[model samples]
Target: MKYVTRTCYLGQISILSVAITLTCVSPNVVSAATPTLGCDDSMKTAFKPDGNTTVLLVKKVKKDDPYPSPSKEQQIFPNRPARFAADLCWVKLLVGPGVPGPTGAPSTSRGIGIEVWLPEKNAWNHRVHALGGGGWANGYEETVVGRMSVGNGNLPAPRIAAEEGAVTATTDSGQQYAGASFAMNPDGTVNVAGWRDWSYRSLYEQAVKTKALATAYYGSPPNYSYFEGGSGGGRQALHVAQNLPEQYDGIVSIRAGASTTSDIAQLYPELLVLRDLGGKAPSREQLEAVSAAAVAACDIVAGQHLGFILDIRRCRYDPTKDAAVLCRSDGGTNGTPTCMTSAQALVMNKVWYGLTIDGSVPDPALDNGWDAPVTGVRIWYGYPRGGYIRSLQGDLTWPEMKSGGPDIIALALGNPKIGTPDFKNATANGEDGWKTLTYAELAAAYQSFRAMQSETGGDPDYNSDLTRLKISGAKLLQVNGLHDPSAWVQGLTEYYDRVMAKMGGPASVQAYYKMFVVPGMSHGYFSGAANPNANPPVPADGQLYRALVDWVEKGVSPDSMVFTSPAPGSESSVYKIYPHPHGPQMSLPACAYPTVATYFSGDIFKAQSYKCR
Candidate 1:
């Protein structure tokens, strides 16, 4: 695991005096990482009884004890191995699948599974670090999509906290089965309680009970608390911040583009693009080649070969125009090693356009129009060109995703009765025709979804006015990859802009909430395109975690950070997710959003050679 020191993330700070230079952060220095709670099931009843929550198992675990592995971890991190950090009292609890009315207790619906790790007391940081789940998971994975579902959460937020001597917890979010399966009912009706548990209740209740359990273990409540997650976990971070402002002192959300929900919504169109027109999406090879071609087309700035698209929203590379580069194909299985069939190209175009009124690409220039985050431009976002190809056609590789579009529409509309809305054949009025939905129809669906959700006591997607979070002095830090295929940076920028306007412009928001949009990084990894010399992405869960701790404990906020990539062929791949140093030759400075890492005259791999302008 990463043992990053205090001076690790300040982005090559040799420019100033070495003695007084502001490293700008602190390493997680817990004297004793795990706590020793010497008790058994009897200790479970020691804490006050939760309304409908049950402490299923309470076991004492030793540091380095083998953690129960998840069934499929490669889905989250195709290449990384998994490891659990520090240890102590491992508490597993179940929350009601039942919610939404006077009878908010357990019912026939599926309940949530939560795991809390109370670190060894003497060395504990007296902080509660609650982890949010990913994908369809209410627990870890896009933050599954963790347990072996999403990359072991790319070695998630909880591991870092637990190892560093902070109290940590994770949840299954009801659908331990993961995804939208829990939202569907036998009679084709909406499972309101299941939806509530998956969307908000599970995560919220997980945090509430987690804190309560921590309080019981430590004798008093924690001095500070933070929520960290990416992808689905990213959504959880924002949900807690907006709905229960007092729950967490900070939110480290990633991949929460659109500032609404998981970019999972983007999958619907891309899936339809391939399924409807081409009959099946292009093979993985074609998708990767298309991404490479797009990267090559846009990787230059002022004649400098930067290897990755700098400003993705402004990227003008079009798949339809790749005829000169990619070989020709017939849209079905006719594609060759480097050839893309006309139908395949068209599918790419439609996917890029997303669920729009007409199948047309939005102008790159008009992205920053007068409207904040610009509503009505399109119903949902499309995957970014040159984004991770694996995320493209490979998303449906998971069995949970085959019917993704229909399921999303069903859940959002809360109409369990909709029963697999037609994709290829949208209805005349276009109520649930997700694939063929017109812009007006799509907008109405989104509105209807929001309206339905609002009636359920809380609307996590809306309410950007985080005046309460700010008043309580809670900080929010978001880290996103500019070219993330699953969660585009466009939505993140829009959300930041909206919150900035509501909370007194950029300056005020930056005070407590700041976002770092990493160029070239894809979902937490670097671009798939062969950029041998590009800087490795900043450790999202590692360095970013330190930055948040510094902000909360030391009052130090980061302005820019140095990104370090493994040498040309040496991308660091340790079994543990801890942030260790990677070497050979890769270092670049990624500036905070609104500003990008602009290349200047010098060594391409050095941070000093680039200006954040």
Candidate 2:
């Protein structure tokens, strides 16, 4: 048999081939032999929910075949897997008239792109895995068809659900993977529907149709359904757990940027501090020195000796205490490379002390209440000694450094001075678009965007309806990296506490949901000491998806899991390696909340040397 490739108008050739033949049944039509049908037809099934929805294509993908995007311009990452096999279904959803099209122009169809991948009959595992995306962007089809199913972070062969023999799906949420292009139309009007799709609707709609497609393909419903993602994907998982508890059996969020409110509160304060210390920002070496000194001072402060502080809450190591070593005697310039300038010291101290304007603390007060005598700022990143301070790019202008460059920032700060052109260009190039707005204006804009996200379900309040999830018997596992620079660890800790307070208590929350804190690990994966190229495999340590499956199918919950760090200078390290007192490769058993990993002597590099206390 000869196979030919064809490209769609959007210039995308799905990772799952549209050429492979499939035997499909039309909606409302039934046949037993449909399960054994071949992929010769394109439109084997038609799903039209209303006048607005349309099922564009349905085809079977054969195993061990090459599948790539239609154009090289597509931003799909990593690479295609060695063998791609699945039943591919494509649908175009309508968000009503006046909805912006791909070019940000008006169109009636308001085409919301959605794709689903199902394992071929022989490889079907009777389960479903839905993937997620990062930043303020919608879930991407590139992820669904991309090499890694769980995500690129857990990649390097095996883990992408389809390859593991489960059904998978992703949607553009009425927009492409291009950051926040869909947030605002060219006319500067808010794309409410696009925001809806980005927030919760896109995932909601795709999950619904995915189940029906699964049943239609296999002739029976899946035994289990799950979601796996990191960062923004984690936020989406929380959204599903709250809004659509019935669709999934299990869900896991890795290093989740769960609260937009916190992002708004702390993001600007850090930017402001850096803004004041222009040309005197701390170098990477200085940042590492601060982290090392902090760890050294706090290592045994609260009955813990470790690579990274296991529980930052109990350990209150002050950076200012080591100011003599950190600050230059002259307080001008020409000091030791390990020390901070007076200006740099002031900025660092302010960053540590979270969001404050004119000595007045902001609402939803900083979550660093555990810090005894809480000296300065004590923000999220300030808690853990090596909490990714080096990751902050302060070289950029104040405007560029704000909000870490999310497209949603553009929408929020876009006013008369910094209009659509600036927003669009700022996203493309690292332009200092915020200079156009006054301090008051910028503050107002941030609040506005934060409110919009909250109302639209983007900035989740952590007040998720977990009771509904518990009632439905669904399982949720939230794994947070102690050194996550983007999301505040203290904030997340507080949110978990609120869950316990709102619900019954730790036991009640634990029955349905579990939060695990990874020691020594930074955002995504890896500790400061691990090599970016040689970092340890995340799943090898956490077994996230596998754990979810066990809990959903066998009623088992993850307690203590040993996670390893990638070796120095290895191919697996995807991020930069910072200095830490620990060895090149380290392992630790991350424990559930209220319990910390206590050091017990002997071969500190191995996880078995320590016990979860």
Candidate 3:
């Protein structure tokens, strides 16, 4: 990693010794050149293909091009039909897989899909941006068509950038939808090449491909490139920063989850145990009550009650201390929803502390005794039940019909190279494989899972080679919601700490990267409110995205990110609401880590009342 002197400055020292210090800066400065390609130019012949890469489409779309109305479920972009008023060149490419990934990984020679939308010369902003997909996403066609459906997955970049004359692109990550495991070979082994693409290679491939297409289409490469996404997308953003930092100048990761394999391996077993608890198992409502109680008891641990705790580490309210409120004489429901039964209380505490049994998971390669519990209902108790069942237990009915889930289980169990019969036999006869599995056996299987995940670049390792990112001076913004259950918030905080340690401690990490912790927000978005997805689940202000752009292009680091929700009874402001659609509007500021947002005084519904302490 080489650092170049960006600007020269001379400063005199006031000390007795006369000495001058020289500082080398490398901040991203945008170029002012305009694109030379015209809307009616011959872009088709200009795009030169890479190995196994086929340029599928290169056509100009008028401002009045007919865009179909998005179905109700895909209505995240309400005004997307006419949003891109400028002439646009839509380019689609099919990059053949055999491309080798990060050193030693399998080659992705299969078909990897990519689409780059570029504005005409008049609308061109001399820049490019990439969109990220959500949970186990196999494709990103929805983004190109202007319909982003994940939790706050709808970024302003595609619409705003295109209208502003910038280019944007997305990839299918080699597979087509949520079930990326479909890329497995027919013999029940991983299609290493396809899996390689799914791991992290597709992003790099897509970026390289898009840049080539942009150069051919616009007569020059972009001045700057950016990437943004939430959840799985956030993980991809981290990958770009970690493995391919030179590709993007700025990156935004919202509620980044750990490796998919890691989450599945750890979370699936916890769910199985929770389900096997029989009647003692707590309901989602009961779990939420425990969380509320925890908030009430621990939120004040930092000296002020802000309805929720910004820093959970500062508060250690024990669930056992509230036994009176949980345990009734007969272990029955206490009538009030706030109380729990004795069995419920015990189970809840176990969840709060996560599974600590001897065989819960394989030990980390670089263990610091940070094997903490996956608490609360959101990550475990409140996750999408169908997703768990479908991904793991082979969609088999629970309690009675247990055997036969998916071969992916073999991968999760640490036997990535197992055959279909071996996979079937592993789960065919017992209580969903849990009954016959011993601690030693489970630990071995988990070890295999981790090894394969790392080889495939799927394991969310604590450290990465960030020297390139730091040296290049790319800006990285990572935001995690404290209450997001799908991905353990603690794990992310721990990862950031590890990055700090690996990179050179707090100051070094803070130079080019910063993390913000949002209070009361869920995995990908705010879930406590009704119709959280009615609008992009993130802050309506899009401050994080704007903040990254400012940092990258203007060298302005945002001090605070203010998040806002629609005022109470204004659910109609964005889209339709269902289920429980009533809650007070909220406005809060998520300060950089270590400095938590504290409620001071005045209007609590406004962010001005909160200060980053």
> Which regions of candidate 3 are displaced past 4 Å?
1-45, 64-86, 98-109, 139-161, 265-276, 279-281, 301-305, 318-333, 336-339, 358-408, 414-445, 460-462, 527-538, 569-587, 598-613
Candidate 1 vs candidate 2: the TM-score winner is 2
lDDT of 1: 0.57
For candidate 2, write residues 1-613 as lDDT tens digits: 0010111111221111222121121222224655532333433444443344556555555554555442111222244244444444322333222254544332112555666665666778887777665655442434334423333344411234444777776666666535555566555556665565666666666566566566666766677878776776787787777766677888887777786645544444445543565424566667666656555555452353444555556544444445554455634333577776555554554455454433223221234335533234322333345454633544422331235333455566543224323345312432555544433444555567766665555655536546777776788888887666666666667777778888889888898888887765666565542222222223353378778778778877687456776665443443323332224566777677756677677665567777777
Best by lDDT: 1
Question: Measured by TM-score, how close is model 1 to the native structure?
Answer: 0.76
Per-candidate local distance difference test: 0.57, 0.54, 0.54
**Per-residue lDDT value at 51 in model 2:** 48
TM-score of each: 0.76, 0.78, 0.74
- lDDT of each residue in 504-604, candidate 3, tens digit only: 88777887989887765655444332122212124553567778888888877766567775443443233332222244556777677757777677765
Scored against the true structure, residue 367 in model 3 reaches a CA lDDT of 21
How many clashing pairs per prediction, in order? 29, 27, 16
* Order of quality (lDDT): 1, 2, 3
Worst 10 residues of 1 by lDDT: 421-430
